[model samples]
Target: MQIFEAIIGHVEKRCEAKGKRLTTQRKLVLRALIDANQALSAYELVDYCKQYFGETIQAMSVYRILEFLEEVHLVHKLNMSNKYIVCSHIVEGHEQGIPQFLICSKCNKISEKIVAPETITGLQSHARQEGFTVVSPQLEINCVCDKCGQ
Candidate 1:
């Protein structure tokens, strides 16, 4: 939570090293995601970008940047709701580890937890025992919050 700035800095450095232009729009979008504790959809991101950045920021451009961010592990795409969230870790590549999403369907609050290597191994072993190959850990658990229950 307190280390988003460090992650953004590292990402910027990586982009620089790769000779990729760290465009203003890209920075803004990533920053918005970093600032938002909850996952945001592209539409939400586009709206925020347009509001804070003015009308010059096109939705298509936002989508493109979001896709690139997702590709590079700077962000993770939530399959349950088709939203995007900044990765819990600033990993170099996207598909290195199994990402477990703790999502609340009622309030739409999302928390990401990275599966340890051993946990993954155990999961794989269990899957193998069941004659099934585990692919992804995109978990979306539905529940009612305390406030909502009251």
Candidate 2:
């Protein structure tokens, strides 16, 4: 539980720094995401909040909370899986280089890591050559995780 508290504290600090409000409902939704062992869709989050917090959250509310969290960089939305994960940097109190997510295609488990700056620069250069702008630096690569690979 200490880990959750630390993450929550970091998020609170971030929200304060950004002049945003972390409402109770938003906190509950964020807590549910943080407690989850894997990424969860907003519908799954609704069920989780109901089961764990006794709060019957609607999908729309959860999505709004998720959007707010993402806006503050407290959570990340995995486009491929249509799920969300808390930003790994929250625990460290600072972000490193470009963040990348390695996702297990089978189980949808996600692991966050930082890729070297040169790697991203290379990809950006390649995109520029193709006349495509690199909007977000985040990358999500799908493959089977070790546990699932076994």
Candidate 3:
């Protein structure tokens, strides 16, 4: 609980730094994600808000809030699963690099990592050779977590 509050504070400060306000609705959405501690689809988030807060939040509103959170680097969207997770580095106050997500296929648990810049450069180079452009630097790898693997 202490850690969650700290993360929320950090995110609030970050948003303020960008001249943006983390409104109550946004905080509720963020809290839902933090409490779940896993990637969640916008619809799932809406259900969470309804279940936990007894508040009705539209999926479209959740998506817009998520977009704002992503813009502030407080959340990340997993392209592979079309789910959103709070950024892992928020509490650490670390500068973000290109994010890569290791997703547990069975449980949908996600581990976020910052890939080495050189590795991303190599991938971009390879893509360029194929006459392709790298649109987003985020990468998602599907795997089974140790517990699930066992």
Candidate 4:
């Protein structure tokens, strides 16, 4: 609980630095994502708010909040899963990196990894060779986590 509060404080400070306000609704949505510790759709976040926080937030509002959060680097959207997760770097007090998500196919657990810049460059080079443009270097890999694999 203390750690969660500290993370919230950090987020607040970050927002203030950017001259953006972390409104109550945004905080609620962030809290829900942090508490869940997993990727969640916008509607799932709405349900989570209602179920756990006893606050009613519409899906549209949640989506807007998510967009804001993503813009500020406080959250990330897993495009492959069409879900969102709080940026692990923010929670862990680390600098942001090019993220790669290992999504467990069996248990739905997601592990976030910060990969080397060269890896992204290599991918971009490969895409260029294929006459393709690489947009959004984020990678989502599907695999079974250790626990689930066992």
Give the per-residue lDDT digits (tens) of candidate 3, residues 99-145.
98899899988888899999999999999999999999789999999
The TM-scores of all predictions, comma-separated, are 0.72, 0.88, 0.94, 0.95
**Cα lDDT of model 4 by residue, 47-98, tens digit:** 9999999999999999999999998888999998889998888855456779
Model 2, span 1-150: residue lDDT tens: 897787777778878877998898998988998888778899999999999989998899899989998887778888877889888776565655778999888888788998899999999999999999999888999889999999
Model 1 TM-score relative to the real fold: 0.72
The residue-by-residue lDDT of candidate 1 on 2-100, one tens digit each, is 575676677888777667766778888887788776788888988876776564567788889988887666888887677888887764534547788
Error of 4 at 50 (Å): 0.2
CA lDDT, every model vs. true structure = 0.75, 0.86, 0.90, 0.91
- Against the true structure, whose lDDT is highest? 4
At residue 136, candidate 1 shows an lDDT of 69
Better of 2 and 3 by lDDT: 3
lDDT at position 126, candidate 2 = 98
Give me the runs in candidate 3 sitting further than 4 Å from their true place.
none
Worst 10 residues of 4 by lDDT: 88-97
TM-score (C-alpha, index-matched) for candidate 3:
0.94
- Specify the highest-TM-score model's number: 4
